[model samples]
Target: MMEHSVIFPDHRKVCALGQGTWKMGKSALREADEIDALRAGIELGMSVVDTAEMYGNEEMVGAAIRGLRDRVFLVTKVLPGNASRTGTKAACERSLNRLKTDYVDLFLLHWGGPHPIEDTVASMIELQQEGKIKAWGVSNMDVPEMERFYAVPGGVSCAANQILYNLAHRGVEYDLLPWCRERHLPVMAYSPADEGRLSRNPVLMEIAQKHEATPVQIALAWILRCPGMIAIPKAGSVTHVQENYRSLSIRLTAEDVDLLDGAFPPPVRKVHLDSW
Candidate 1:
């Protein structure tokens, strides 16, 4: 497994395996099984976990990481509609309570709609001051929106930006990725496998065959090659988690990277209309 400290500007070292808790619920993985999966992830050196109040899995995550809280970098998000400073503060406290923790390592603005972005960001800053959250950022934000946040007085550093980026969905490459790179902000890629689409791509298959690795590894390896980039892939089972961890060892050549890039071009038009 890949074991390395991913340092943010604030000098925090986060684990790269970042367990995604979107599927951690009785309906999804069963409460007991979810806890087992989380424990296994930590044993395998995964220290960062991504979750949200909207996911209904906070309690499960809290229960799983109860004793290991300090060793994990817990991140969660707030819904955009709850932009009122009071509402945001209440949400943070509720999340802390649900997670059975004193504070989250990072709190993200889930999106930039339903309320003025400024209102929500300002609230996030206030939460930081009160020590409810250590750092704050935005998810699904575009270039202009990110720039606006960066310009705010006392605006926290854009520690990380979460978005859908993979070999198949390289739309962010046209602008967002480069912008973050220039600003020294890490791009946390969700769906780095293209929702499993890249696992079946013929070009990736050929590359995987060359290295005796799975296509998923090749895709993740490509993402790791970029500076200021990390991927959070959800693994519901031990086998899937192991597969994702092995991605760190599959080194790709410069030629391989070029081939994969050519094989999977960025989308020419917007595919998903619904807001993430």
Candidate 2:
């Protein structure tokens, strides 16, 4: 198997920086601009580019990684509503066609839905066995659901867990993080800046001033500091991509980390899907 730097424990790589393709398919974004942003991200050392079949941005991502396919660690999710073995398998094939690749570095179940999780997980494993994907994981899953999924045969090998983790929403800190630590499952944080909230927070701004760094950089760096954590903040422009990359350079001191951790602790949110 090809070795990847982004892989965390259990042979998963830290998907260094990635471009989320949600906006690429928007009617407002001109094709040229979308392509430009993707090219910029690749040039800037963001090897992982995340997309989803539901996003309708797979074609754009496929175009972006055309010549650079070998270097990029492509990841995409299958929507939960489409979870049957046949549906899932067909979706993966469609994604492969749209992505212009035979296999993806990681394929994730977008969310836990009504379908039998075990059935979908089994299909995912079959894909891996067939060399259609290198690894598999789940997104937007909580500690209990994650545990349940892991309990399924051939499921404990889940490589990563993508969640909405950021400075403002650190609820995962209480249980998810520790659970992942025990299983060696890397946590892939999406919206690490809380949709630009942390990027402009007053407290974060003050901390950034002390370090002479941008608040967004501080937030992303903080996420990266978490054990077995990786982040995939979206970049809509080249400037934003450059700015996000700068986060990798800012090293938070022990005191700085403590202050930030105490200042903005995890929020209490309705995390249980059972309630939803």
**Candidate 2 — which residues are off by over 4 angstroms?**
1-6, 9-15, 267-276
Give every collision pair in model 2: 6-13, 6-14, 7-12, 7-13, 7-14, 8-12, 8-13
Q: Estimate candidate 1's RMSD in Å.
A: 2.5
Report clashes for each candidate as comma-separated counts: 0, 7
**Cα-based TM-score, every candidate:** 0.91, 0.90
lDDT of 2 at 11: 61
With candidate 1 superimposed using the best TM-score fit, by how many Å does residue 171's alpha carbon deviate from the native? 1.1
lDDT of 2 at 137: 91
Please give, for residues 14-107, the per-residue lDDT of candidate 2 as tens digits.
Answer: 4455666665667654766777777887777777788899889898888878898877878999999887877788889999999989999889
Per residue, candidate 1 scores C-alpha lDDT tens digits across 82-161 of 75667788888989999999999889888776766667777888888888899888888888788788777655466888
Off by over 4 Å in 1: 1-5, 26-29, 266-276
